[model samples]
Target: MMNILKRVITVLLCLILIAVAVVYFYMKQPQFGALPEGVRLERIKKSPHYRDGKFRNLEEKPTIAEGYSLVGELWESLTKDYPRTAPKDSLPSVKTNLKTIPADRNVIVWFGHSSFFLQLDGVKILVDPVFSGKASPLPWGVKAYKGSDIYTAEDMPEIDYMLLSHDHYDHLDYETVKALQPKVKYVICGLGAGSHYQKWGYTGRQIIEKDWGDKQEVKPGFTIYTESTHHDGGRGFTSSQALWLSFFIQSPSMNIYYSGDGGYSTRFKKISEKYPSIDWAIMECGQYNKAWQSVHELPEEVAQATTELKAKNMLPVHHSKFTLAKHSWDEPLERISALSQSKNYRLATPMIGEVIRLDDPAQTFKQWWKAVK
Candidate 1:
């Protein structure tokens, strides 16, 4: 019995060692990215949002609500069956040649799941572009929905600025950004995010790293303001190692706000007070659940946040592209659309790759998700 026990212990130890080796080597892969260091680390440490070796939300609450655990969520995902979590048929899309777009046109094109392109007053901006068809570090998982990935790196035009909200795999895809480097001029990311850009071969001059309160004039008449959001950011083994930010963009004629993957908070009230006239608010209205409600907002919360922002228009995003959460692919739109009745802000629901004319008040989009399974 003693000899049998010893043999079993030896086998278990060997298996443990193998698991450790696999994890260590897998994390060493380039996609996991380098951590903040040297000057960047110094800057991150000094941030008001950074303390106790990690970046935090302004509200200072748990990322996942107390009742939820990763293990529980994982088990539920594996055991439960949720229909249309991803579309069964190819989603409809309207492709436009980005380069051929009129130079004077003021428009926005959403590529799905927090990725989009904006052209305002002759200046072009791309936000959280993940065209790699997968939001995970692993090649096979978190795949993009069918017909959702109609755009690619090669489809992009000359980019004036690439706005990276954070370092999450979905928002900051490695392969997509690497392929888009040539066309991109400058990258605006939160503090510590440039470390990943640097590792990916982006030059120091090309990266504009900013704290939450910092502002930059990317062009003579266009400025981007970094602001606080209630979301954590990390790419690999790390958690909240850098800031996740929402952006307030000001052009001579337009003011836009993008709440990058954040939960509902009083920050929206404060932001609205600062910028009295946010003409358009691009809000994340998907991938939400009570378990993680502390991080991602539900559709009802999205409406409330937009109301607090005093936004004239709200474009719901972060859904209809991937199944990051167990809810049906169209549940967000379904809920938000139903809840938006009598709301002060106009709901903008443009289809994937469809142009949203920034100045056109009569622009209308059909209930596109209703036609899909």
Candidate 2:
């Protein structure tokens, strides 16, 4: 009995050591250029991890219990208990000819999820682009819906700037980034995310890392500032070891906010206070459940959160592209539109690849999902 117990302990220690070594190797910071002049490392005052009026060093969270069940249930439905009815209509298709933007004001096009293709003052920018067929660490893990080929990285026009929110597999695809690296002039990322890109061989013009509220003017008319999000950032093991953020783009003609996957918080009100009457807010509206309340905002909360931002117009994303949640795929749109109608918020109906003229924020999105399912 004594020999067996000692062997078990040895095996456990070996397993622990192996995990530590792998994490250290994968999570090492990359050699990159100096962060921009205004950028600095800092912590949020009122974050959940704060205590005694000081920021607590975030401990490594082994796993998130809250969202674990949601992911498990979603997996079961996809594998074992899929609906008897056929899957909904595949995502909308974009025209073959990728639309060109005139050297003029700002135009935003949704590539599904939080990814958006923007041309402001003739500078092309792609935000949170993930062109891979899946949003998982492995290509075979979680597949995206079929038939929604609005644009691929190969189809993309020369991208002047690539803005990333974090290093999650979904947002920062290794294959997509490697393919587009040559054409991309500049890459911007939240603090610590540059480490991931560095591992993936992003040596040329390393990403511009910024803390929340840190602003950088990419050019004359296009400026990007990091904003707050109630979410943790890290690909695996460590929690908040890296920074997660939203981008606030200020152009000559428009000011827009991209809420990259976050739970509801007073930060929206703070952002609204900072930039009142934001022209358009690209917000998350899907892949949410109450189990993960602190990580993602539900459809109803999305409406309330937008009201807090005081946005003039809003576009719903993070849905219709990937099946990341167990809820009926189209449920987010159905619920959010109802909530938006109740709140009287101006919502834009932007099909994948459809150009949303920033100046004319009056278009209503068709109930595309209703017909889809």
Tell me each candidate's TM-score: 0.98, 0.79
Q: Give residue 283's error in model 1 in angstroms.
A: 0.3
For candidate 2, the per-residue lDDT at 31 reads 19
Q: What tens-digit string does per-residue lDDT give for candidate 1 at 228-321?
A: 8888988777888878989999999899999998878899999999999999999999999998998899998999999999999999999988
List candidate 2 segments past 4 Å from native: 1-86, 96-99
Give the Cα lDDT of each candidate: 0.91, 0.71
Clash pairs (backbone) in predicted model 2: 349-365
Clashing pairs in 1: none
Stretch of 10 with least lDDT, candidate 2: 31-40
Q: Give all candidate RMSDs, comma-separated.
A: 1.1, 5.6
Q: Write the per-residue lDDT of candidate 2 for residues 1-373, one digit (tens) a residue.
A: 9999999999999999999997676545331112211223333333454345332223332233454675775676668754412235776655533445566756788887777788877778888888877787643677777665456788778888899876666677777887788778778876656656666677737567666778988778778888777776656654454567788888777888889887777788889899886878889888776767666788878898889988888888887777776677777777877788866568876677777778765555667656665
Over 4 Å off, model 1: none
Best by lDDT: 1
